[model samples]
Target: ERLGEREGIASLPRPAGRLVWVHAASVGETMSALPVIRLLAGQGPVLLTTGTVTSARLAAERLPERAVHQFVPLDVPGWTRRFLDHWRPDAAVFLESEIWPNLLAACDARGIRRFLVNGRLSAASTRNWRRAPGTARTLLGGFAAIHAQS
Candidate 1:
């Protein structure tokens, strides 16, 4: 059975208790999030979502027992909404800077707690964000907490 079959998402059983959703964009993000996933698993089931096939494979091999890996649905509103509705995550943790406006908006709309771990803002991106402070605030401000790494 394919782990990230989009159609299969609806059929996937919801975690029994609190569900924590973690978005790790690719291999590096997945690696960075492994320890965090383990920690979150101790509290509740963890849904680890990554954007690349390679990351998914790595996650399967390395994620802790209580963590289930999934391919992150596209940032499209409909797809994201379906994914979020089915998973109904209690809280969300994003690795690095994998920020998806639609996904974050959905989580914020639902009032799901959010955190950004090891976040990195490149100099160029910082300049762009600085140009549009309001947009940056609206998007980045949604996170309940941000842990940055130099």
Candidate 2:
């Protein structure tokens, strides 16, 4: 808890400006969001969150000057609530189909605008999504916007 308070809540030196919260699921998602992060950081602070140790390290090396990287907390309710309270990002961009139900619900509840970039639902995954009709519809409804690669 202390570590999270120390690092997670550290304020950016830059003046308060638009913050773009980029949530990437892993190394690939982290890498894919680099261009967007670079563009957005020029406007304000960028907080990059990934679920893997490797992605955290990679983003540290690769993300832009005003960008900070951290491992995303597990999507359990309490942890996510803490995370949301600390960061309080202005906008959120999720890369490559990372649709965490709890996280998305929290974001929605907070009125945090969200976008999904480079997204695709594979046939296998689509079948699974279909099985959970309520979950799929609920999750799908939360995305404010989506950008597909092709």
Candidate 1 structure quality by residue, lDDT tens digits, 34-74 = 88889989888999988888998999799888889888887
What is the TM-score (0 to 1) of candidate 1?
0.90
Best by lDDT: 1
Candidate 2 lDDT over 1-150, as tens digits, reads 324522234333322677789989888888888999999988888988887778878987898888887677777777787788878888889988787888889899999999989988878888989889999888877788888774
Candidate 2 lowest-lDDT run of ten = 5-14
| Poorest 10 consecutive residues by lDDT, candidate 1 | 2-11
Model 2 misplacement above 4 A:
1-15
TM-score of every candidate relative to the true structure? 0.90, 0.86
Model 2: lDDT equals 0.80
Error of 1 at 133 (Å): 1.6
